[model samples]
Target chain A: MNTTSILDIKNLHAGVAGKAILKGISLTIGPGEVHAVMGPNGSGKSTLAAVLAGREGYDITAGEARYLGQDLLELDPEERARAGLFLAFQYPVEIPGVNSTYFLKSALNEQRKHRGLPELDAIEFLKLVKEKIKLLDLNEDLLKRAVNVGFSGGEKKRNEIFQMAVLDPTLAVLDETDSGLDIDALRVVSEGVNKLKAPGKAQLVITHYQRLLNHIVPDYVHVLMEGRIVRSGGKELALELEERGYDWISRELQLAA
Target chain B: MSAVAPATVRPVEPATEVDPWVQPFARLESGALFPQQPAWVFPLRKAGLARFAELGLPTLAHEDWRFTNVAPLKGLPFAPTLAAPTQRLADGELDARPFARLPGDRLVFLDGHFVPGLSRVGTASGGGVVTSLAAAFRTHAGLLERHLTRYAHGSANPFTALNDAYFTDGALIHVPAGRVIEHPVQLVFVASGEEEGRAQHVRNLILAEAGSQFTVVEHYLGRGTATTVTNAVTEVVAADQVVMDHLKFQDESRAAYHFAAVHADLGRASQVNLHSFALGSRVSRHNIHTALNGEGLECVLNGLYLTDGDQLADHYMVVEHAQPHTASHEYFNGILEGRSRGVFHGRILVRPGAQKTDAKQTNKNLLLSDDATVNTKPQLEIYADDVKCTHGATVGQLPPEQIFYLRSRGLPLETARRMLIHAFAGEIIDRVRCAPLREELDRLVWDRLEQDTQIQVGPHA
Candidate 1:
């Protein structure tokens, strides 16, 4: 394991209630690397994201997951957030009557406070938001409206990336961000994610399709099957899976067994 | 000697006893209360007294009063406030109240009696009339005879009946035909806590003639912890094409009992917006009823209530449409914590031949404690075949998913909870058409919520 890895998972096991979901998952991603976890529906792709974000109702039966050399499971969801981890939800919740601008400002200020930096006032925050909003091609009016109250499918996905831009987290987890986007929306969102990529930052892109990989190419591709990584390879593996589906991988595993 | 009783101690007489709840109030309704009133007014007062005598205090048995119990009122020895306090209010006393800085003409009442010294009356720029009801009797008697007690009669509510019979003074606003009052006329009632169990009955009359426009606010405040009672009645008459905005804000002591009845009669093509904010009092009940009497009229009733501790807040509303092409929308939200309770009953009625009537009502409550509760009922009665009406009621705590979403964005659990609660309240407060008043209420409500330690998500968690 690389000591400077942004994320390191060792035989991680998690389940909801008494039912197991993610079984014996292990992976490692170093600085500035974008890792994509590809699996079919119900292969526990979302569970991996939820477990990393510290969502309630999930029991980590066994394993060790570290974020930036810290025991990630010990921190609360918000603590993980303040420590520079961001999750772009697949289904962003609508919070009526809570202004988006105000919510984003509060989130940013909390992160800043945790980092021992001065909080941004309204003007400063607006300036930052204005610069980042253009990258996602989001309307300024949406910022004034309630948080995701009446957003379209594409707008909501774009909003997730927009928030990632403003918060500027260290490790971004894009959980199926390309699930509900059209080609134009996909291009815009991927562009926004690409713009936020930095040397000291990293990303874990969870997707079920290869079309998104074509836009923001990943450094490493891991094929997840039934809660475990069956194969790991370079970026070429994503194209091969996209052309030849998961049947070949299953056959390969059968032969190996 | 064996009995240890003296002969002078005659058997306690089992004489007829007036109900304790009605005795003190009944004694103050003599002819001397308003000696200068015309004979025609006497009949109205008599009818009010008669209605009060028949109805009396409502109990839990009454269908409308099922959620609220007024049994505690029977124990208090309350007397009508006939005279003002002897001690002169210190300078700037009225200024300490809400909306004091807003530009307007204000009528100050101490314990329900108009205090000229603390009041500021100016000739309305629009040639409208703004004065105390006591003075309006001598000046605008004809207008009063035609409009006063006409809408808010004693038959509907006991509190209104009592107010009609014993109200000392209140605001009398008359926006003449085709005139527009630029500034809101504020009616400020301040309870000095000069004595406990002081009952203040206030009656306000607002008449906006055809093509007139104006705004009026009736504010009630308590200065001390005295167990006072404020029973108020406001009757509004808006003629054709008139625009009237009315607000009633009650923030009395938690030890006080507050009751108010507001009745409005809207004429053809008139637009009326009625708002109520109930943030204080041990037990408060507001009855707001509006009648759409003519065609092309629009009426909106918006209200918000915040209660904690053992306090109880209740609002009962009735919107009646009697003519075609009339629309009414009602929105009310409440935040209750501690062991407090909130109740809302909204009824919409559309009469026969009142075609094209559009009406909608919604009541939402946020319960921050496991012990806190809310009872909401939304009803509709449509006799017309062509009408649109809808209503809904919801009572629940903050959505855990919403809390998680905010927390995932780096906000602490406590901050996220407060923000969501504020948003729930903002849904209604943001409806205030008046910009300054809305902003003021936003600040005041947030300040009050911040001081509440129970507002945090703990007991519910």
Candidate 2:
């Protein structure tokens, strides 16, 4: 397609608390490309997401990750976020006493300030958030409450997507964002993701089922097994793996090892 | 011996030389000048005065008073309330006190005397009673005599003794059986007068009958140039299936000294929540004692203190689990800025037969300056082998990572640091059940924290 490459990861080996979880994983994402990562549990898909986000309590044993021609591992978590890299956590942290709208605005302004853009005050930010809230069908009352303090599982997942829409990151990593969504919410979240896709943006969707891929329609499918990507193919590969199940892939990886 | 009289004992002593107040059995004979108070009240006041004269003021030698010095009290001469109120309070100033907007029964006292003109009494829709203690003594003498000074006796505290002797006007709140009061009853005590070194002996008695529920808020404020001392005592009795929420807000003037004691007697299946907010005063001390006298009782003691500018505030609490299947919790947090100091000592005791008791205590302090200091001690003494008890204390500044996270979001350094401080204090403020009071106190404390110019936002990486 002759698209410009935005992210290049070569042999990323990382772990949490000194125990390796990502074992020599290689991937490259070009502009306007959608890559769906499907794997069984404990397959290092989340580990790869965490490593890319620069979360604390993780050590990079060996890896080379370049985002927008800059070393990604040298930045802190917030710094990575400011650099247009966003990770939608599988389990979002519930920060009590911090208002939802206030937190989101602060995060948005931080990214804006990093890019030398004028900051948006409360009124302007609220107007911006209101436009995006309609895309996700979220209630206006959710913004008044504390950040995910008493939200249901599905609501929290939806809220994460809503945050992604507001931040508008260049490289968005969805770490199992479909784990707890219902059918209706799944559609809403998928539509939100679709509306945000631009010619200069890329997305890495980490999931365990083929149900979510039916809506987002990834360009490439990668099968991660035992901390490494064992197979890479076209979008049809996800459907074949979904129908055949993960057992055959497990055996194939074992035989290859 | 007569020719060379001994230097030590030369003259004969007078029989009447002994101070009348010093004698143990001396009766306080009311002269004509004594107000025509109730006759039955004289005996209790006389006994309290005699005990106070015998014990005198607390000194540094006493274990409880070791950390606090009463030397400033020695130079002043304090007498009972006989003079008029010197500092006249403005209408706006008085209306700004906490709970002024709430529509409930209120009792106002100025210099230990009831000011009926300023007091407002609403219809008791909850089948309860809210009145002055002096008036209640004449109206419901039997109930007043039986419950007043009952729990606080033998407390071994000199301030309690002084309060018992000289308390002229106080609050008498009685919630009837099977009744729940929708609005909270507020007791406002304002210290104003030119009588420097004058003392206000205040007492409050709250009795909740079986299956009753109510809330009480005690507010202390000062408004004069004179230095006043308030020695206040409150006794709460919660019967079976009753619930009581008691909140004490101490915002006296910086030139004032305050001493308060609260004793709660809880019965079976009763719950008592005691909260204290200490913000002002040169020296303030609060002693809260919760006695779980019946089984299936729950007592919670939550407190917060903010001290600055050489002020000192101390909170000492004791939770006694005397019966089985009772639960008690104590949480006290403090923010010390400038050269101010804070102290928290929480002791929990479980008796031998008090099995299945769940007791937890935590004391946390946030020091905003290098010169600020805090002394926290959490003590647990459990004799019951089957009881579960835990205690912990933490003393540190704001988390640097949290502060930096806010600062990186384009907020100014001062705004970011204040936000963290507010968040740290918010942990406790959020627990306050009263919404309006909680929000007001939050704003007040935030304003107080901002006066410090040397507070550092991000100290660690």
Best by DockQ: 1
Each model's total of backbone clashes: 0, 0
Positional deviation of B207 in candidate 1, in angstroms? 1.4
lDDT of 2 by residue, B245-264 (tens): 89998989988889999999
Note the DockQ of each predicted structure. 0.80, 0.11
Q: Runs in model 1 with CA error above 4 Å?
A: A247-257, B1-30, B123-125, B454-461
CAPRI class of candidate 1: medium
Worst 10-residue lDDT window for candidate 1 chain B reads: B1-10
Each model's TM-score? 0.94, 0.72
lDDT of each: 0.86, 0.79
- Scored by Cα lDDT, where does model 2 land? 0.79
Tell me candidate 2's interface RMSD.
Answer: 4.7
Per-model i-RMS: 0.6, 4.7
